[model samples]
Target chain A: MCHRSRKTSRIRPAAGAETSKTIAKERLKLMIEAEKQKLDDDTLNQIRHEIGSVITKYVDIEPENIEVRVTLKDYKKRA
Target chain B: MGKVITFTSGKGGVGKTTTTANVGAGLSLLDKKVVLVDTDIGLRNLDVIMGLENRILYNLVDVLTGKCRLKQALIRDRRYQNLWIIPSSCSKDTTPVLKEEQMKRLLGDLRKEFDYVLIDSPAGIDYGFSLATSDADLVAVVTTPQVAAIHDADCVLQILKKKKKDIRLIVNNFHRQMVKDGDMLDIPDICELLDAELLGVILEDENIIICQNHGEPVMGKHTVSEECYRNIAGRIAGQEIPIPDYIRRKSIFSRIFFKNTAGKLV
Candidate 1:
């Protein structure tokens, strides 16, 4: 027979050192950037150019203003 | 109000349209009312994927512009009674034609009527993508195992993360054979790279392409692909269903001898 002696249970923090959102974001950015760099520079440039053209046509922004920063896509900033 | 889930991809030919169509059909299988809106604008493929091109009376453009009512624009699915699709305009010059406020208003109205509004967003991280996913309750980034698709998906994820939007991932066209042979990027690789919650994975099934060509979604194929979509739909509807990621190839010997483990025949 088992006795019901579970009254001492309490909530506690999770195991391991928790990572902050900012650090996690930075780490993810680095990983993604590394993966993107695996592609040929020529192909990456062509894709960037294509994105610039679409933005110029639809958003009416100059090519210079249409920065294709691989850090974060502009839609998030705009939203 | 019903939830609006947007299916978007960073690159073209990444199966965004097909995923949206299948998810809509799967949701309908659960007796939930679902409307699939083709927001691809100029490069619309949802109509062709769903095989409802000839039935298109009006489109999202017409509904937004007041040329046609929202209900009039929706084409009821030929098979699923609870499913509908709002096709996109055939005009390729429909750039910058849709506005966010108008879309929000249209979706707001739609939310009151349906159980789910699934938007088939266009590829690329441009204006079209922004407008399509501006007001989405959930955004799913669909990607294949290829490096190009994965890189773009990462970029898309960063953007969504910056906006603090809830982001989910769907790994499509995943081939277990390739993954087992270490020839293709696996699911954990994708999840860790993007650092996003995974909604589901759709294994490589020729039936999906065949169904698209025939204008029928894979959800009705009753194959492993169908099971994938059904599980995804159940998850989308807030049900606690385990995603059946491991699918075994149909062979009597393998079935009789091998224990199926994560899409491998070992």
Candidate 2:
């Protein structure tokens, strides 16, 4: 697994707006590197509860009453 | 255009003929026009399974050989007006009957007239199977939960993918009692093991064999097996009908041993 800190450190801009385009391209490459998955309903429901409970413990929310929904990432290829 | 779907299994006696007959019948029951073609040439079974054996005046060979029109060759189902069967003949060797081109032409012509042209493919991944599935828009790979059947299904799935044919898995002969006893593989287990999208599952029902012996289409027969075929046909027609849960029944062993959950106060 790639840590967010490590990924950010490597893909950070070269200290100026001159390299903004390069950073954007680098980030696009990083985004494409993550795995895409098709999850079933049972797994998705379990994930919602586990993640919701952990987040509710950290934030101002009730774990039992929390609601969580997921959406697939939609994208189109460039010609 | 009518969709051409082939019901196939690399292993024989896995209910491919039965699935084709009932799924076609179920689709016709839903008012969709269907003509089932038995591509298992020499050992034709669909006509007999659907009980249209005596009605076959001209088989698929007659049409392909330019002896009859496609419409003239099809035997209309007695039970459903919308369903028909283009049966294969057992009177002669079927080895040279179907060339891939001829099969394509036949399906192309049939596609113009019906809502669905379902083919019962011959068992194995040989010449008969290749010709049968040549023009299929979708292939329903039928299989039982047995180890050998699933292994053969996996082989068929691999070959279908290699040809880039649209494929879906149909697990047949699922037994509720056997499944509950942990003696049978369930739908999810087979699908995962085969790594193919499941179209439907047929339970091991006595009604299917009863209907077959009586020369009747088993779908819409007020059994779980009937519902299974209907749901499969619905999905094939692009209706998203969820797979019906197997009707739960208490196992004989369970009923005998665990009849009383309440402990005795003695």
Candidate 3:
């Protein structure tokens, strides 16, 4: 019973539907971003400062106005 | 000195021990002297899977505690002459019996004697995982195609990156057909998501479980799983064998006109 039969037929996905693999990848990406946001205050501040510096190089942006949030809702909405 | 490679996964039941056992055996098949150290203390199963359970007179705890010499604790594999295993203690206490410093010293000694020292780490990112990877020259993070496994693997990868350890990813139990059907993540997607070098991928074959149940590795057998293990071991031994192309997602044109023939697109 442990033998995996190679005869299992492949089932094609329905057109225009999101595949399970895509959903899984998106979920994992969100989970990883969420986990990364759990960094300590110092690291988060450093990341914020770095981001502010990078943005300031391109355009005028206040450091205080730059907020980095790893929210699943926003990511899902963007997707 | 031998290279110390620790096989770890942040999640359980993702084939870490199986990869360690078979990769160790595969290294030995390539005429390299390899010793697999089971660091999953108190829950050791590598001995049972390697069919050397009855031969264990001394465990890793005994060696670490100085109850026995290092050589006395190593159980030689029955199949490969150059392969051996150091099983962890199977005590009920889940506390890590081997400290990080002691593990490094033990690995130092192992490095002088073998060509490859493979450590089978326990599940979770706890003390046991730290001890297993404390002195690893390379860490192979094993994960399946499932989202949970991939997420956990990413967490582990982040930790390893913090430690500045050289890391690689091994995808286990990959169903190529499922990937083709868009039901499972493909190889490239996993490599990109994990952001680690692809060590190798093991297809979802029932023979892996069957071989483990038989207390033998599937490395030398003429099976797809065996070839996968061999390629992994070859890569570990610094060979340049390319990963099989069939594991990658086929293009629409190829899928429409061709079929998989013995693990190859035709």
Top-lDDT candidate index? 3
What DockQ does candidate 1 score?
0.01
lDDT of 1 by residue, B58-106 (tens): 8888899899888899899869979999998755355486789999999
Q: Using alpha carbons, what is the TM-score of model 1? A: 0.71
lDDT of 2 at A64: 75
Q: Write the per-residue lDDT of candidate 3 for residues B158-221, one digit (tens) a residue.
A: 9999999988888999887888789998777787788787788888876665555556787655
Worst 10 residues of 2 chain B by lDDT: B257-266
Q: Taking chain A of candidate 2, what TM-score results?
A: 0.39
Ranking by TM-score: 3, 1, 2
Alpha-carbon TM-score of each model against the true structure: 0.71, 0.70, 0.72
- Poorly placed runs, candidate 2 (over 4 Å): A1-79, B247-266
Candidate 2 lDDT tens digits, B1-266: 89999999999999999999999988898889999999877677887777676677788888888989987998888679798889986644445656888888988899999999999999999998898888898988999999999999999899999999988888899888888788888665776688777788787776666556556776645665777888788878777666655644356643332223111210
| lDDT tens readout by residue for model 1, A1-79 | 1111222222121355332333335544753454344443445577789989988888867887777855444322221
Fraction of the true interface contacts (Cα pairs closer than 8 Å across chains) found in each model: 0.00, 0.00, 0.00
Per-candidate DockQ values are 0.01, 0.00, 0.01
